[model samples]
Target: MAGVDEPECALPLDSRDVRCCCLLRSFSHFIVKNPTMNCSVQTPQIVGKDAKQHTLSPTCTGASVLGIKFSDGVIIAADMLVSYGSLARYLDVERISMVNDNTVMACSGDIADYQLLKRRVEEQTHTDSLLSDGFTLSPRALHSWITRVLYNRRSRMNPLWNTYIVGGLESDGKPFLGYCDLLGVSFSDDCLATGFGMYLALPLLRQRLEDQAGGDPRKLSKENAVQAITDGMRQLYYRDCRAFKTYQMAVVTSSGVEVRSPLQLETNWEIADYVAGYE
Candidate 1:
């Protein structure tokens, strides 16, 4: 748990209260101060008990989002482009998650907040109530829960630093694709993308997605799905400055979740091969 200062301890609790380090201490006091008070607190999902609210703006972060569909699995690709202020920095970031035996949670945001959300979602199923009630959370539901958390942070005037694209199986065990941004905005379907991907990759994907109901890549074989997602990455690299050929790819299917980091593209880069040059 994080610590709280005296000034924060004296403020009235409300929906707009941004959680600070001292807030935890105040929270601890709340429990002690009112043993019979009924309350529920929402914490970042994956981050452990010590996550803090660092005040930062949401935009100007160079994040990536891509969606791929094939005839056994679906692939979601995100560049490891972590930006420092306006300058694009860090290329070894992997935005995809292998959270469980069969799910992958991916994100584009404040790296710390992303990790926190991942941890919380993983811990949910381990609790006795969810297991005993025979009720399990689907990828869509988890996506929704994450959106609410982001909104809550925004309400407090302190928001998580990034957007997210969550991919996994649906309640019926079918492949699912969904996206949610820092504002808690969410949309699920056969294909979806956020950030630069919404412009670069979505146009190519919608052709296949609108073709049928089972257009998600998860319905296809892993190899085909991987190829589709890789092709999309290639386009994003050529167009999006924050993206490159090298990326992290993950496939979620009935078999399991597979993630390959630092995946690169082999391309012919002869400058004048296809164009007339000054010879």
Candidate 2:
């Protein structure tokens, strides 16, 4: 039994070692990390027989975005829809990441890439040396850092394979929201959308925005902004099967970040008049 514990090639990892493994996983790439050695062994970052070609895995897609603002507040909503190939295999793919206590990140891309981005962000949060005299990562600095990280990877021809929407309170404690895409193209707009949703869902959202002067939801309440999105989702549901009757939504404000699930609308008989004579 004692010999079994000390095998010829290696020793079994104890619970404490296993705990370190868990931490390493949460703070690392997909490969193993040897903490005692104070070194990291990166696994294959990405593996594909055809490295030069682009293949859509059942792992990506169903990426969507909906944002609303009311009373100087911003709310973002997305569905956890991960498709396997063209087939909508997984309807519950979560694209959101929590950065520290005040930020939320929504992602779209290869799931593996998304995971890598999350690990890198976690590692950043742990490093005390990176902070300025002020404690906590500055929102502007952090956003710029994230953008550069994504862009650098793309320049290496190994892009992170993700588009991102970052929402949270800034260092000055103001509500902020921004968007970054796979090519590292980033922009901060009062409203934004990505994926197929950009096509079908955005038009309706724009109309709503026009109702409030291109993203001014002060004319509307948080509840109404959310309702606008809910209504848009219902419209997309009838138009896009990839979108669900149930979706996830989030709101970011000076109050903090709030995310919800199974957010749905009552769609029983209200649209009968719209489809009455068509079909």
Models 1 onward score TM values of 0.66, 0.68
Count clashing residue pairs per candidate: 26, 5
Q: Write the per-residue lDDT of candidate 2 for residues 1-279, one digit (tens) a residue.
A: 232233255777777766766666566653345455555577885867875854334256556666655665667777766666667777666676667556777766677787877888778777743665456654455667779988987787667777777776676666666888777788776566777667887777778877765556556667667877787777767776666666788777776667887566567756656775555
Question: Where does candidate 1 stray beyond 4 Å?
Answer: 1-62, 69-71, 86-88, 125-136, 208-223, 271-279
Candidate 1 overall lDDT versus native: 0.69
Model 2 earns a TM-score of 0.68
Quote the lDDT for 6 in model 1: 34
Q: Using lDDT as the measure, which candidate wins? A: 1
| TM-score for predicted model 1 compared with the true structure | 0.66
